[model samples]
Each structure stands twice: as C-alpha cells, then as structure tokens.
Target: MASKVGHPLRTLVAFFIVIAALYGLMAITKNWTPRLGLDLSGGTTITLTARNTTGKGGVSATSLEQARTIIQQRVDGLGVGESQVTTSGGNQIIVSAPNVQRDELIQQVGQTAELRFRAVYQQESTTPTSQPGNSATAGTGNAQGGSTPSAKASAGTGSASAGATASSTAKGNGRPGPALPTEPPAPPSPRPTAPGKGTPENKAVEWQPSQQDITDFASFTCPRDTQYYPDVSDQPLFTCNEAGTQKYLLGPTIIEGTHVTDANASIGQSGLGWQVNLSFDSTGSKQFEDATRALSQKQSPENAFAIVLDGTAVSVASVDQAIAGGSAMISGGGINQQSAQQLANVLKYGSLPLAFEISSVDTVSATLGGEQLQAGLIAGAVGLALVILFCFAYYRGLGVVVVASLTVAFATTYAMVVLLGASVGFALSLAGIAGAIVAIGITADSFVIYFARIRDEVGEGRGIRTAVETGWRRARQTILVADAVSLLSALILFILAIGSVKGFAFTLGLTTLIDIVVVFFFTKPLVTLLSRTKFYGNGHKFSGLDATHLGVTALPGGRRRAGTATRAATQTGGEA
Candidate 1:
C-alpha cells in the first residue's frame, strides 16, 4: 500500500491556529492565570458525615448523593472557584474550597436548608429599648431609605398592646404610622389564657402565645436566642433574621419548603429592586391562599409572614390581599441581588434528604501551600531537564524534533488549563501537576516510538523521505493504541477515584489528548518538512541519520562521488 502523506504545512498552520485561538479567548476573558486547587492554594477542607434525620439507622446512598449535590450547589452559589464536593465513604461527603472562610463554608454547607412559612405573631428589634414600652416595630426600618416603608408599617410607638390595629402598608408605598409597641410590658397577674385551637376559618387568630412564650419573646435577644429554637412545624418559633437585626415570635408552619417547586431572583417589575419569585405545588397553593386570606384580615404585624430557613427569618413581607396563585414574591428594603439569589437558591434546591454533621475542618495556610507548589515545580523542572538530556544524547540532531514537540504540547496544555479554569471552574492541584509531569514521559515515549520506527525504515534500505512516511505509518497505530490505553485508564480512574485523585486523572486525560494533537499535527509535519532539507535528506554525519549511525551501507537516493562507496565500506570495516 502506498503511504499517503498529508499537507504538512497546512496541518501545522491549523494546529497553531487552534492554540492561538485558545490564548485569544483567555485574553478576551481577562483570565491570564489558572485557578489553583485547595492543595495548591491555601483553602478550607471540610469533611461531613451524612445521617438520616429520621430514626433510620444508616444513610442511604441516594440520600447521601442528593445531599452532596445540594451542598455543591450551595458552594457554587457562593462563587467560590475550584471548589470540590465529592462523596467519600458510604455516608461521608468531602468538600474542598480554595480561599474561603471556614465558618462561612461551614454555614453554607452544614445547614439542612429546611424552609418554612410562618405568620408573625409579634416582631421586635433586638436593640435595647430606651423607654419602658419603646421598641422598633417589625418591618419598620426601610431596607432602602424612603418616606414610605417597603412593605410593613413604619416605626412608631404606643403603650403595650397585643394584636394592636396597625395600618397595613401597600407593597411599594406606605408612610410611617403609629405601630404597636414591640416590647411587651410585665405580664399582669394571671396572664390572659392562651387561645385554644380553633377551626381553619379563624386559624390565623387562634394560635396565641402562651405565658411562657410571651416571657421568652420579651427576654429573647436576637442572635443569642436565634439558635435556641429548633424549627418545628407545629410549635411557635422565637428567632431572628439572618442579620440578627429583628426578632420574631412566629406561629406554626403554614407552608413547608417541600411545596416550593421553583424559585428565581430577578429585578422586580416595578424596577425598584431585586426580588425572589417563588412557585408552589397545587397543595401548597391552596394552603397558601387560605393562609394569606386569613392573615391579610389581621392587624399590622399579624398580616406579615416570615420566610424562615433553618430557624432564621430570611424575609418578612406583609400581605395586603390574598396571594391566591401558587406563586409569591419576597421583596423589601434589604433584598439585593446577592441576598435574593441566595434565598432563591435555598428555596430552589429545597432541603437535603439527610442532615450532615461536619466531621472535621481543615485549613491549609498560604505559606505551606506556596512551599508545596514550589517543590512540585522544582521536581517537574528537574524531570523535564533529564528527559531533554536523554533525547539529545540518544537522538542527536533528531532530538530537536522531540524538544520542539514537547514544547508545543506544554504550551497547548497550559493554555487549555487556563481556559478550562476560567470557563468551567477547573483548578490545578498538586496531583494535577504530578499528572502533567508524568505526561512528560508519555509524550517522550511517542517521540521515541516514531524515531525508532524511522531508524528501522532507514536500516531497511529506504531513502530518508520514503522512510519518514513509512515509519509514520508503522508508528501511528502504536502511538494511537498507547494513547488509547492511557486515556482509558484515566477515564476509569476519574470515575472511580475520589478527592484530589480525580484532579490527577483529569489532567492526565487532558494531556493525553494534547499529545495526540502534537504528534499528528506538529511533530510529524515538522519532521516531514525537516526531512526535505539537504543536510537531513543526504544523511549527513551530524544529522543523526548518517550511514554508519543507521548501520546502513550508504545513504539511499543521495548523490555519490567517485569511490564514495569504497570509502564507506572501508570506514565500516575499520569501525567493526
């Protein structure tokens, strides 16, 4: 079969064009550096063990996987680059993030993310009251400054009153009005009896605070008492918002988070600010409509409901009319894009199937990370130097091809890493670096195969040009098979491995692909072009393809002077 050679120059040009395009994209994105992983850069690593919240004995695989995915989404929502959330043991999840606060990381991933909607029985500011009855009303202070309160009544004070009639504010317009005192006075002797459980028609007014509940609400501070209340759907909750600014005594759960089907954050139709829109299932829709209808008829704070997450009030919005549809919007003074998006994410992903307990929190210092990175680079450099030395010592002039091919492969790999980092949050770790270093040998092996094949063809009495093509035909299959095996192994490893080992597998598979590109496009084309040169074609002594070096009688298809064959024979005999 005739050996078909490709358009070497065109292939070379196309390959370089692709490389140039990668760098161009990097420049456009303004991302000049690769995102390093937790090991390479200082970061926090947390290990979590999943336990079934119910009295189940062991964690199910499906539940653990679901928890990992939810936690991963939460981490990504934080915009932490190169964060990894992977399942380790049967019930354990390993989360690694570069350059993130430990407490923030824990708070984000540790929460069960249970969401609930509860009617606000009472609302009070956490700050100390100046007078006996003076206290900031719930939803009074503007999230954004304005003459009108965002959704609830503005700040005002009156004598202690339970369920006082405070005028309800419209969605976007409402002036400050006299509000019921947030702080309750000392309970009179024989405190009024708590309301009994009533029918659904008057359920909103049925659940009144007991004497204990009222006393606890008065003494309960913002953040100090926030964690004390466990979110039970049947019980009243005394807790504060995430910012610890306002505390609330909330009625029983009106709607559980499970009913929420979708949530998204976007600019309000009024274009005033960002708002989170929510959609609920059919059952939730009816329940919500009923709850809102009843709550809308009540006085100031009672008309407002709190969207609680993990026992903290995310937002409290007043209901002017019955929200009959399955959808609702949470928008107020403090609702910005970040807060809105975070709330949306929580509602969208809902709660995890199982609760996760943080087993260990590990922090890697920047200095130690830097030292490790430096050491890794030094080892890679030393290995590359040795490879270069071996290539030159063995292949002589042909070593130039090996060096050039390796350089192209290295450049292409680096550009890909940087581009992947910017586009897909792929971070390079120490294991990834080691994988790249190992690829040096893999790339060198390809050159060695091709070069050896070329030498065999030359020894079989073929001219340099013919041998170049024929040798490639023989070496191509071997190179492809070798790379395929390597890629398969990497794929398997990536699939089966956990933690940083996946980083290694990813880079290995990535470089293996780059090796194929460099060998087929850059290396072979350059070698083909070089073979057309007189020094190489004539098999000059220093060209690493001399007759003596190749163990051949003479250079095939080369001009010969008088007695050249005689001199070649004499030289071969003398060397023997």
Candidate 2:
C-alpha cells in the first residue's frame, strides 16, 4: 500500500502520549481549583453615571473616557486586585471589585477621586527650619492666602519687629534658630516669641501635585484656594500648612498616572520584600524631571511628594535630585507581596484607555454563588455520565476509548481553565460552565466521526490497517472544517457580545480550539494505533464499527447473511 501523509497509528499514539503527559503534569501542579467570580466571591459592584456636575450633564466620549481614567485611578488607590472597570451605555461606568469588603469598597469607590497636594506655610505645631537630613527657612513673613504644603513666610513690615531677634539670630553662627518655647517666663531664651504669648512658627514648603490633581479643574467651596504641586519623584514626609499645621498642600500635577506605560512588583533590589517598579512615557518623564528638580531645591518635607491613591497616602519619598529617565522605583517599609502585585496590576491596567462608573450595585451572597456553582458541576457531571452511558450502549468495547478520550479532554480543559484563572484573571461564570457542557457533544461527535470512518473503509473491503488510514484521511478534514466553523462563531460572539454572552463566547471559543487540538493530536492517533491491535484488527463484533454488524457488503455479488446488523452512512459524511 502507498504510504499516507499522516500515519493513523503514529498520530493516535503521539496524541495520547502527549495528552497523558500534560494531564499528569497538570495534576502534579494541582491545577484543579475552581475559580470563583465576583458574585461567588461576595464583593461590591458599583455603577456610576458620568455627568458634568458643574455643567448641565453634557455627555461626551471624552468625558466618559476621562471619568474612566479617574475612576481607575481611584479604584487603584483602593488597592483592590482584579477589579473590573469598564464603560457601558456611553454614559455609565461599571466597577466590579471581587473579594473586597463591600461597604468599605463602596465608600472608597463612590467618591469622585481628587488628587491634591498643597505647600506647607505655617503650622500650629513646632516648626523645624532644618531637619536632620535637610534644611529650610524660618522667615517672619506670611502669605495671607490659601495655605500650601510648601509656602514660604513672606517678609513684610513684620520683619522690622523681628529686627533685633534677626540680628541676634544671624550672629548665632548661621545655625537654625531654636523653635520658640510654648510658654513664657524664661527671659531671653534666644528663641524669639511675643511676650507672654506663643506665636505659630512658619515654615516654607511647596506642594507637588499628581497629574490627576493638576488636570482636575474642579472647584470647591473652601476658605483658601491653595495651589498644590507635588514632587513627582520623592515621597513627602510631612507636608505643612502656612498656619503651622502638618497639612500637605498639593500643587498641580506635573505628571499623571496615564504617563506610566508599564508597572510590576518584584523582589526589591535589597532582597527585602516586594516593590513596584514603574516606567513612564516621554511626557511623564519630562514632567517628573521638572517636578523633582523643583523639589530638590525645597525643604525635606516639601522636597518629597506623596503618591496619593484614592484618598489615602500609599507612599512618601524625598527627591534628592532630578530623575531624567522615565523609570522609577517605589520602596518602603513592609509593602507585602500581594499589595505590591496589586499596585503593579493597577498601574499596568490603568494605562489602558478604559474607564467605568457603576450603574448598579448588587451583592449576591456567597451561598447563592455556591448553589449555582454546585448546580453547574452537577449538570456537567450528569451530561458526562449520560455521554458515557450512550457510548457503552452503542460502541461496546470501543466505549472505553470514548470514555478515556473524554476524560483526557476534561482534564486538559480543566487544567487550562484553572491556570488561566490564576494567570489572566479569568473567572468562570455560569455561561462558561454551559459552554463546557456543550463541549461534551463536540468531543463525542469526534469519536463518532472516527469510528464511522473506520467502518466505512472496512466495509469497502480494506484490512484494518488500510481502513484506519483511509478513515483518518476522510475524518480529519471533516473535523477540522466543522471545528473551524464553531471557532469562527465563538470569535464573532466574543467580539460583538457583552456581559454573560461574552463569557459564553469566550468559553466556547476556548473549548472549540481545544477540541481541534485533541482530535488532531490525541484522538485520531490513539484510534489509529488501536486499530493495529488483534481485537480491533480482526473485526471483533464488540467494536462498534464491526463490519459483520454493519451488514457491510464487500462485493456487488456477495451473498447476504441473515441476522446481520445494519447501519446507514452518516448523511452529511461529517462529525456534528
């Protein structure tokens, strides 16, 4: 016989051997965990409609996109992992934060995120002109405007009143003047203060703002309109107000989070724990350099900028010098591996031009999700069992191949799903399970096609070896074409549909791809090898495609035998 391009026995053996090895590795890796979705995990999902509160709700794609960007920044500030942020209805934003504490998440998510950093002017507390690592000025002047984290005391007529003190202070060897005592009665204590009254010490510090804070041209009713700019490089230590209070006044952001191109958490250079590494685009790099240069000229606290996420400060570091490059590293105390990873995720995903506001908030109890999951599993089990039963009743000894192939398919699918969930934030929903159930039919059809093809070749008077080759030659094309159609449908659905339908489409697409792989690699090869066996090769009656049962007529003049089984050719000559 002339050799065929694809050997059936070789194909079958190679497929099963590879699948067996993959399944074994998956099992060894414990790739059996079922992933829980947001509903199952019991978290908060919020929807917000983006409307210009200042304007008369004039909605635009730009506004929607801006809102999404802001919302992502806000959500990231919350440090929630695998959170879903997307837009819908052109005006609404959807946020799904799974495994998050609902009420707290709601509170954090509900607020329109605002980023601000104000300069330090005068504080109500003790003012240090020069701290240990850095130094600054303690002028007797004041800016009678909004307090900033890094505001200098303006020298005015008040300088005359402190002339005597100034001379004495200047003569004291250019050292930082001591902070005035809280109480009086210590005559000539060198620390200048009004007699019998305590004066608030004033310190100069500039506020560095983030890009969000700067871009946000929001107006609010406040006693002071202090402008804030943040040191984009270094994290701030203690932002002080002009009133001598430890209040961080932020400036307009020179760089925004949008400038970041990529972010990831990894082991710190010191081998301590996790730290987030960030890289920004050209614009962000230039802005960062300028901001850092400005801060380098300021005091310690003012020389630092705070990375404010949501409403809380995640980090503060001092900018020793200007950072000319786009890359930066954030390192601090006890940033856990999980938190670092979350930060990286937020930064990485934040760059995508995706934003959403919650239009609805629903909390399905874990019990409900559990029930649904249980039902889905039971349904899958029932379907598998039914398929098994049908194979046994129809195929006899060949039923074992059907069962084994199905098991391998299941193992491969489950392992892939679990790993995808872990690696890509893929959550298996009800629709996904249904897709898997539907896959049962597809896998079964593959077996039926192969078996029927073998029988057709055998009925044509070909020996088992030739039948296996001819059958595969015919069956493989049909399987590929059928699967191609299914895969195309899945791709279309996944691309065009939304919500749960997309979930269905995704699973369908994934399974369709897997089906093609298994049939081509494992099933056909294994079946080809099996046809070489004595039981199968000798046309055992128990083999579902046995020629005797099928009433296969080898020749036109062949005599008919009574009580022989009969089967019709598949009408379409292809698998379902």
lDDT by candidate, in order shown: 0.72, 0.54
lDDT of 1 by residue, 33-130 (tens): 88888867779989998887754689988888889889888887766655789899798999989856776677777878788888877776565332
Instruction: State the weakest 10-residue window (summed lDDT) of model 2.
Output: 134-143
Per-model C-alpha RMSD: 8.7, 12.4
In angstroms, what RMSD does candidate 1 have relative to the true structure?
8.7
Task: Flag clash pairs in model 1.
Answer: 143-333
Residue by residue across 1-576, what tens digits does model 2's lDDT show?
Answer: 224434655576576687677657657767668565565666677877766543254678887777666566656455443456787888787777665566555544454423222222112223334331111111112111111223222123221111112122222112342333334323211221112222111111333333232122121111122233222222321233222222333433345576778777778645865666777778766666666567656643445554444323344455545656666655443466755665565556553232224467877566787788788889889888988999988887788878877777887788777767655556677777888888888888987888888776656555566667789889988988888898999999887875566667878888888888887777776776666676865557786545554456431113331222112123323111
Name the candidate that leads on TM-score. 1
Q: Which regions of candidate 1 are displaced past 4 Å? A: 1-7, 45-73, 76-96, 120-221, 224-230, 261-304, 318-362, 366-372, 452-463, 466-474, 545-552, 559-576
Per-prediction TM-score to the true structure, in the order listed? 0.71, 0.65
